[model samples]
Target: MSKEYNVAILGATGAVGTRMIQQLEQSTIPVKSLKLLASSRSAGKQLQFKGQPITVEEATPDSFAGIDLVLSSAGGSVSKKLLPEAVKRGAVCVDNTSAFRMEPDVPLVVPEVNEAALKNHHGIVANPNCSTIQMVVALEPIRKAFGLKQVIVSTYQAASGAGQSALNELKQEAQDYLDGKDIQDDAEILPTKGDKKHYPLAFNLLPQIDVFEDNGYTHEEWKMIHETKKIMLGDMNAKYIKVTATCVRVPVPIAHGETVYFTVDDPSVTVDQLREALKGAPGVVLQDNPAHQVYPQPLNAVGKRDTFVGRLRADEENPGSFNMWVVADNLLKGAAWNTVENAECLVKDNLI
Candidate 1:
């Protein structure tokens, strides 16, 4: 008989954490037991899994006792503090946070893009940023078929990427607006929670995602630029790939969509070849049909695990450059599903 692992979920009540729970219930991993860990305030709450109610507990250093695997979606600081402790207690952690993503030792992974990288993990495997995860999935096959040289992406991100509270604010603000109530720019938590201003997302678009860095690129944009190279190429080879991104938060509530313009090393690569490459790509659903006016859209992508690709065409101005549209549920393949997929890879390889 195979071993049934004991598993734990950190940040159990957060938006992504809760979706992690849902994915776990349907996952093929033999979960002998499940532990839900969160801050003290969220402790004692009950979350349903596999038709049973599990109590949420306060996450302490000892929370990993006898746990074989951990799926963590906690904030970066919490992950930085607790993941090492979990590893020390003999648990393998798949962290869905930005804390260790750029670390030299950590593997920033999208399982479809770089499952083999998991072997290099000492104790922790980091999930790529939500936006980065979906884009890389769509691009990896193309990269394999035709060597990629440059990539430029602009994202139409959903409110849920900011967390459940941001989604709630969008709803409340939209309702207040529809009622002819004063639409206060009542900004508080978004673009970045710690940033100085908050703006209503109901009927507006924010040109920024995370707070801007000194270089003028927002942190979220930087993640797409950096994480793409990290996942596609190793740490050293990342510089060989030229990448730039503009990430924006739109009013959509579930899925994220992107327009990616990429240059392939093969000058002769045709639009048909690009479509064929993506058509057969794992984790990708090709939806390109121009004559009938078909394409991938956020409303069509919500709740789906596969990244949808459409509007594929060669750039007329730049030889070897092609543009395509990609969309996926930010909370699924973007976060929880990718985390679960990494855990599954670890189990199948017997690395944990």
Candidate 2:
């Protein structure tokens, strides 16, 4: 007999939240009960799990009463307000927003990269940014083998990472464009909802994914830079790794693709050795066979949980530095699956 636990999803009606529900259907965790939670507007909505209809309830402090685990994707503000309450109610939370990720005490985890960090969680475990999650998943094995010194990544992010509205708008814009209508009017809630200006993501690439900081880096880019160091190299060794990222919103609907350039500590490490290391890395799939023109692509990665790596090569001019292409379903391994994987780790380690 398997041990069973009661689990709740904090943002049940949203994009990643829905994916969490779907992933749970296929999850290895033994769930005795599933509670769907969302804002009051989404309450009374019925969602299915294992062919059973589950009603989404309005999330509040009391919603966590009998819950053993909380997978939160209800946005940062919601997590900021409710996660502590969930913890107070004896529920461990795996937060998928930026709310508690940088909180020193909260463990920002990508189970493939930092499962050990879960042990340090007081009650909340943070799921990293979508782009950062997939990037680190592909880079962790390299970092572990050659000792990553610096990382520079440029991301072609899917509109799905923004929100369901953004994705819909992208489709709307494309259709409107093909119909000879004004595509500009279809733009509303992206590259971010908080930004004053909105851009059409259908036939255009917005260089910014979130509001820009004073330093000119968008919040999304900064999340990758800071979160990567935190997840890949914990506090003591964080300073050893230098990370920079440029996040862009592309027309793609589901998966995110990245071109990553990284420098390792050892210059002697060759391309063949790196390829072999990635081939055996857990949660990573190596698709780098240039002869056949095979490589990881966003279309191929959609719906998959593994990080796909390809285009592996050593930078001839910069010894110790290599470039690779990384792709994954932004909603799966990047968000929902990662959240579930963290919960699975906790259960496996008997932390729950």
Please give the clash total of every predicted structure, in order: 2, 0
TM-score of each: 0.98, 0.98
Q: TM-score for model 2?
A: 0.98
lDDT values, one for every candidate: 0.91, 0.92
Residue pair clashes in candidate 1: 187-198, 188-198
What is every candidate's alpha-carbon RMSD to the true fold? 1.1, 1.1
- The per-residue C-alpha lDDT of model 1 at residue 320 equals 93
Q: What ranges in model 2 sit over 4 Å off?
A: none
Error of 2 at 317 (Å): 1.0
Off by over 4 Å in 1: none
Q: Lowest-scoring 10 consecutive residues by lDDT in candidate 2?
A: 230-239
Candidate 2 lDDT by residue in tens digits, 24-91: 88998999999999999999999999999999999999999989999999999999999999999999
